[model samples]
Target: MLYGLIICTITVIIMSTVNIGLEFGKLDTEVFLIILKSFPIILIIAMLLEVLVIGRIAEKLVHTFSDNTDGFNAKILFTIFFTVIGMSLIMTVIGGMLGKGISPDSFGSLSHWPRNFSIALFCELLIAQPPARFVMKKLHLRQEDKLDYDFD
Candidate 1:
């Protein structure tokens, strides 16, 4: 939950900001408000998709591509790569629909996927996952520190 929440928070914020900028062609108070208004639904959808769809697929891809000899970073990189790809591809269409509703624009949203995918992939790799994983590691270590070592 921690990892998911962190990842989703970063992803949603950055993605929403960029998307709103692109849509509005300017980032004013009004556009920022629009981003805020649209954020909750998008965040919820992204979380559900991450857990139910992207997470599982990324795990499988990591296992398939990573060897036992691979370092932790290698596995993590693979997971991040796969996860970003899956999320970006799915979310691009969903975002378009959410913004434009059920219309030709929404249906034509696929054209934007390349740009969206690039942004998502860049942010997830360089921005979101590192902080999320760092926080998870810190919490894991903290929890371990608190564990009762009662081995007699």
Candidate 2:
């Protein structure tokens, strides 16, 4: 979170400086204020959607598939990961189609392969079989509770 904030601040500062230098102060200030005003709305909409839709759906699915009686926790987690990947792919495509259709050249450069690769690497390193079980034991956590860590 700290890193994200620092990057955002740096980006805003750089963009502001560029705008002031390229355009006049008046135009730059106007655009900056508009962005600032719109940011809160964007954040609120995202948060509300996540809380109302994403959170509820994920919670229901996880609980519905939980290994309460039988010992089939893996099936639940497997479903969760696949669901996440499927949703990510769909969102990427939909987001690519917002105001205007995605430009082929730009979309080619910004495709999701790099992100998927990083996520795969992290999963492999942190949660691949015995290593994960061992880590959980060390942390004094159960496998079911470990699902919570996946989100973190």
Per-prediction TM-score to the true structure, in the order listed: 0.91, 0.32
lDDT of each: 0.90, 0.44
Candidate 1 local lDDT, 6-109, one digit each (tens): 98999899999998799899999999999999999999999999999999999999999989999998998898889988998889889888998977788687
Clashes of each: 0, 0
Candidate 1's TM-score reads 0.91
2-109 per-residue lDDT for model 2 (tens digits): 322332233333332332333344556676665565444434433444345644576667667665664566654554454444433433343334313677643542
Candidate 2 residue 44 Cα shift, in angstroms, is: 4.0
| Each model's Cα RMSD | 1.8, 12.4
